[model samples]
Target: MSAPGKSIFFMDLARNAGWCEGRVGERPIYGSERLAPEGSDSPAVFAGLLRFIGGRLQAFKPNLFIYEAPRDPRHMGGQTNLAAIRMLIGLPAVAEATAYACGVLDIREAEAASIRSFLLPPRPKGSGRRKEGELKSDVFKQIVSLGYEPKNTDESDAIAGWLYACSILDGRVGAAATPLFSQT
Candidate 1:
């Protein structure tokens, strides 16, 4: 378990990144920010994302930093968009670097599937795989169950990840919550 009185900052990184930050027992503050704008190149997007994360880190000064791990490209089925995949992979790298630069030594990552499992109800025994929209709706519902109204799927994802992180910090979860990266 993490130290008492620790604060955490969680993110669901993408072209439009979602973020949540607060102490474990308090109400978390969450929102999404657009990292890639029309006509912007990859470098510009990375720079903007860096600034966005860095600014928040400076503002909150959380003790721990956690973000959703990007899906493996090989598991993305027919998604062959190289640029999109690169951006997805780059976001966490940028977030990790920003956390280290900001002096937040404890950094970790959570899998999207793991977060969904921790927050969402189990599917029915005979139910098949859910479509993307259905999963987003379920995530939204889970966030609502936690008493927060997320503005979008991105925000909902970040909040769900935040809750999962809290569970890990409090020792309420076990192996399923192991960090993708841990410095403590």
Candidate 2:
């Protein structure tokens, strides 16, 4: 494959919008605050997330962008989550961001991947989530094949989309090899 020229920016915003504190390597890390507060949806909080992401991207100036596809709520396991519902409503914004970045940088969707694989990465071999090995391997191949891994889901997916777009631009992974779902 030709050397991937553009840089990919990957980012992910969890559906849960609260300051989650978790230990990573014995160090605590704090996540964003919950968008909704005390049984009510705060437009302020929601807009904050959008602004945070949009502002960050604008500052970083990535060549390509990708977003995780939202899930169908009815398909959710009987969970009536307001935040999840809210994310679905905002899906267009995500796509619009992609278009804007493309127009600004003259790049296209290079690739796409499930948020799970991008954010979680893959389970270590002979460890957890072995089934993910194949999918992870596939994404790795696509990432390395295309050429960059933008650390966050937002950036990674966007960058991957851009690389995928580049692949299309260069004609490597065709409509057949780059199917919506690869073989398990």
Candidate 3:
């Protein structure tokens, strides 16, 4: 279990774009690039994601992992982040986290919906959601408020997810608290 205010690792996984955030006693360390293959492409794919996960795990060795895991699809032939999800599920570090995830309490998404709510941008009257540019700006602004300048949507989402997870860990976002890996 995490001691109060302990640092944690956060991941925001998407289609081909993903970001990992690490906050150690309040320091910003973010990543989007993957580990490169030494010679060939055989291990490149899994290495891309797995290596990132592993590197973070090895470096931080966090006590808890607050990950916005890939959303599983309900329908057949639907686009899902199965590849990334599968790799994450099988990682030794992740398995370790799962075994002792009680302290995690909750996980938050940095996807469009979460970003929209977390960073309520000034939308047009009768607007549905913030557009790409607006979201980027809004997300950037929110991260900046948190004392970090986000370079892209992926980075913003990762940082936003981290912030939400911190709130959950700190008992700030009440009631909506559910188990980790939930899309609700």
Please identify which of the two predictions, 2 or 3, would achieve the higher TM-score against the true structure. 3
Q: How well is each residue in 1-184 modelled by candidate 2, as lDDT tens digits? A: 9553443333333343311111111111223333445555445545655665465456555555433444568877878688758766564355346447445344222123432333234556878553535554555455434334333323333334333343443444323224343232
Better lDDT candidate (1, 3):
1
Colliding residue pairs in candidate 1: none
Compared with the true structure, what per-residue lDDT tens digits does model 3 show for residues 16-113?
33454554346547756534544434235444656466656666656557656443445325655665445444433442344243344333333446
On TM-score, the candidate that comes out on top is 1
Model 2 accuracy (lDDT, Cα): 0.42
Clashing pairs in 3: none
lDDT agreement of model 3 with the native: 0.53
Assess every candidate by TM-score: 0.87, 0.42, 0.59
Backbone clashes, each candidate: 0, 24, 0
Candidate 1 least-lDDT 10 residues: 175-184
List the global CA lDDT of all models. Answer: 0.83, 0.42, 0.53
Kindly give the stretch of ten consecutive residues in candidate 2 with the minimal lDDT sum.
19-28
- In candidate 2 the C-alpha lDDT for residue 125 amounts to 82
List ranges where model 2 is wrong by over 4 Å: 1-4, 15-42, 81-83, 91-184
